[model samples]
Target: MAQVEIYDGEGDELLFTGQFDFLPRAGESIARNTDDYFHYYEVIDVWHREDSEAGRFQACLAVKIVD
Candidate 1:
């Protein structure tokens, strides 16, 4: 489970939404459980689209939960 969608173009979008379920510390790598949270995603600036030449642009990254 992993979702991070942010898009707020002045009344044209979403602000913030974060979901988590990405455990990749390998059972338990010392240092206080390594890391479990503190992820961020951003792209909220009028949708930005000046030809996007190599700027790369993609949204919606949810649905990815395996056991």
Candidate 2:
């Protein structure tokens, strides 16, 4: 599984956070919520950084608004 953090088009405001079993590749689209409306976001980047000693696993994703 991977942790997904979604942000606005400008990457300013953090809109939502969730988890999924598969990581989305670049150009892929995924549904997300903003305010109360759902929208699709095109995957821009997927980063995985883990710290075994600290027991932390990070999965950061960058996406663009895709109506």
Model 1 residue 61 distance off true place after TM-score fit, in angstroms = 7.3
Put down candidate 1 lDDT per residue, 1-67, tens digits, no spaces.
Answer: 7443434334545545545464222222112121684433332232223337867543332222121
Reference-based lDDT, each prediction: 0.35, 0.75
Candidate 1 Cα errors over 4 Å, as ranges:
1-3, 6-12, 17-54, 61-67
Which lDDT tens digits does candidate 2 get at residues 1-67?
A: 6666765647546667888898778888898676899888887777666879989877667778878
How many clashing residue pairs are found in candidate 2?
A: 0
The global Cα lDDT (0 to 1) of model 1 is 0.35
Q: List the residue pairs that clash in candidate 2.
A: none
**Which 10 residues in a row give candidate 2 its minimum summed lDDT?**
6-15
